[model samples]
Target: METESLVETLEAAGLSPYQAEAYVALLELGTASATDVAEASSVPAPRIYDVLRTLEEREYVETYEAGSLQARAHSPSVVLDDLRSRANRLEAAAEEVERRWEQPELEAGGASIVTQFRTVIERAESFIEDAAHQILLSTTVSNLQRLAPALRDATERGVSVRVSVHTDDAETRPDPTLFEGVCVEARHRPLPAPFVALADRRRASFAHHPDSYDRYGVLVNDRTHTYVFYWFFLTTMWEPWETVYEATDPGLPTEYLDIRHLVRDLRELNWQDAPVRLRVDGYETDTGEERTVEGTVVDVRVPFASEADTGFELAGRVTVVLDADGERVSVGGWGAIVEDLEGTRLTIVDAPTVE
Candidate 1:
């Protein structure tokens, strides 16, 4: 039974039955001539030399000569090590080819749907593995646990990973330590029914929770629907108020009610004809210089429901334009970051010139 199992294992590892039997015969015999190997194993005399020669080439056996044909089996450890190295080289080559290969444009625009829970999990894993730039995941703690390996792989590759963990009930909340060092940014938010994953803002997957046992999900590659998911994920699911970065300054206060009112009042100010004067101060991100300027508010760009195109998609980003010291300057970041800046206050200097 043991010999039979060995033969089967060797065959599964790409060795021919004749090669497997001959190699095992040599192992048992300690050393053997070609004819002796054929007698001890099932390999025909005519093919035994070829089988042994092939095994020798694969590092599974070594050839020897002592005035006649001889063969010896290498230790299994040495043979497996060689096979593992070869497999690693093949995997690296495959990755390089995939990296340089251009995918043919699909007629369906890459849109797909899977109606099985297992398939949904598989697709999500594939998306995470193929991520190049960024990955956004909004899921419950239970689902995040399933995807931990793939998420860790993406983070190790330097992909920016942002996850918003949620819960169906308060008692099932996530363990914060599970996400440590595996995500660039992570936060907790109310669970949005159904799980969502967006990769590179170009592809997305949505699926029902495994606990529901329902088998259905979507793999969206159509640019329009993918963009819709991206917008929704960034705007609603990953809202700034809900996002609490681990690296964010903890010393900063969390109260923003007063700032919100201040922003609203600033926007409501009707500087119809004349520019509204204001004071602004913040460090220049590029130069690291302390910048302070008193100038008229050229434009107050707020993230509202109805606004003209300003090249920003997420809400709550309030960009203020100012003509400071005769130079038009524009600055904006996350609402929290922008509002938290030191010495950033707006005051009416010359009110509308009395219109």
Candidate 2:
């Protein structure tokens, strides 16, 4: 390296500017008087003596009387060893930074904002691996491939996984075969969308596309906070998209994260007068008491629908009426208010036969 660059590097490695300059000058000089070192380096003449003294104290140089006070660069071995040690520390620090960026830990019960998109992806992979009930995701085909293994593992464990793939190009469509055994359902969205992964209604990871001017990610571990992203994924990236692939048969007993989904399926069964049983797990809306209600589903109610009506509304009130021990009880989803119970997990213990 050039003398100036070397001087700067030395300063970065824990040397004063004057000390670095004087040391470099003395190395070139072989052995020189204080006056000669100052002339060769940019260190001020008045400060050269103090700089040389400090360097000698730090063992970068040796000073002695050679007619007059003279200074010489210490053996190259000592200086080189220190520089190499600093270099090793810098390399290790760089690796640590990359590792933290790739595997950031999000705190529970709150949201974390991160600068790197990879952090969101890595966190999403971990969330998928730990998912117990459901996984909702929206991403490009390439990212789907990256997360396929995790998604497959989730499915193998009976976790419901839904994926929506989006791209800006009209002709660029993801192959339907890519989702087989990986997810329960896969949809094709004809617009560019942000990457989103919501697991079990408690954790969510969202990231803006790399092409966007402002790139960042949001990781939510709170159920209330994650609910906001769940609706975003549903309304924008999921609901309107065309289904590219869906499992031919999602055999019983099925699990649902949202009461709306459970109601949708229950509506069909109700119309057929088919007997159904469910295990509803949630907390009481008023008492805040945890309860598990398992019984036959007697009726389902929506805002503008009757028991005779089979059509379902996308928005508004949805309640599942159950008969537990011949006593009628109501179950609702997420932010349930009108219903008695705010259901979190709904498992259809016995699904009625459908041709």
Candidate 3:
């Protein structure tokens, strides 16, 4: 392949070009002397010792006898561990950059802060190969180029990886062929955005700008609802590319809508029976902001209900302040999915605030 890019990529993996070159050369030429590594890496004979010294210190290579230094790759398991090590370092470095960004005087256009983003991509690449459960990705040809290996790996692991393949070639795009042998499916959509990967619906890494992709990206792992949007967006793109239908009874109990809406709007206190002056003890199931909202409930799904918890399906004409999550809501969360309906009355501890 391209040695320059490979060297750059290895550098990204915490190797110096000299180290990358010398090691790669060793792999290509088999155990070699300092003279060999110097000639192979194009480093001057005098500087080869310095590069070898550095690589040797990092356990990337070993030297024995003057003029006789040989590079050795850590075993795959050890290499993977080492990969994770650098990823952790990059994560910490990125965190520091983010902390610095919070500084009042840390303005843009100074120092560029590009290295921080490069570390983010590094973090994403490290975690991508190990992705499990689900893979939510947004596409850009360039960003996907960096993520291809991870997606392929996830697919091989049998993870349900769904991708947002935004391309101009709508019909011919996605090249489903690209993922045929793997578990991942590349779907096409219209997003003029760089790549984003949400692995296992937990952590997410998204590129900021094309030119600066190698310079900066953000890694939001366990961040509040980053993956939720990623999942929602992926679902929106992939849900109905094909058509299907299911039948439901027209008349369902309001008790069902009550809990569903409450959970949906719990963050903003959209309890139908109440207003905003509510207690925090009434933890929001919705996670949206609370305020006075007058509108018809549009849609809802109650997974479980009993005498203590009124459960039913509710849908109607509607409008309300959507969660900061834009306009997507689908009974999301791990709150009690199935509750007793003992009282036959839905609970509302308080109402929303009068805006």
Please report, as a residue range, the 10-residue window in candidate 1 with the lowest summed lDDT.
Answer: 251-260
Residue-level error in angstroms, candidate 1, position 187 = 8.8
TM-score of each: 0.45, 0.78, 0.36
Sorted on lDDT, best first, the list reads 2, 1, 3
Q: What is candidate 3's lDDT per residue for 1-355, written digit by digit as tens?
A: 6877767867889787778887677666666788877887877888888887887777776777754555554344655688788889999999887755632131222212233555556556765776655566666555666677777777677555655665544454554455444433455665444556666445666665455435455555563455344545545544434311112222221121123344554434443444322111111333422222222323333434421343223333222222222433222221222211111113233344535
- State the lDDT at 135 in candidate 2: 90
Q: After best superposition, candidate 2 residue 297: deviation in angstroms?
A: 1.1
lDDT, candidate 1, 183-261, per-residue tens: 7667777554568887754577887766666757777766567667766666656654355455334322111212233
* lDDT (Cα atoms) of all candidates against the true structure: 0.66, 0.86, 0.50
Please give the distance, in angstroms, between residue 154's alpha carbon in candidate 2 and its true position after superposition: 3.6
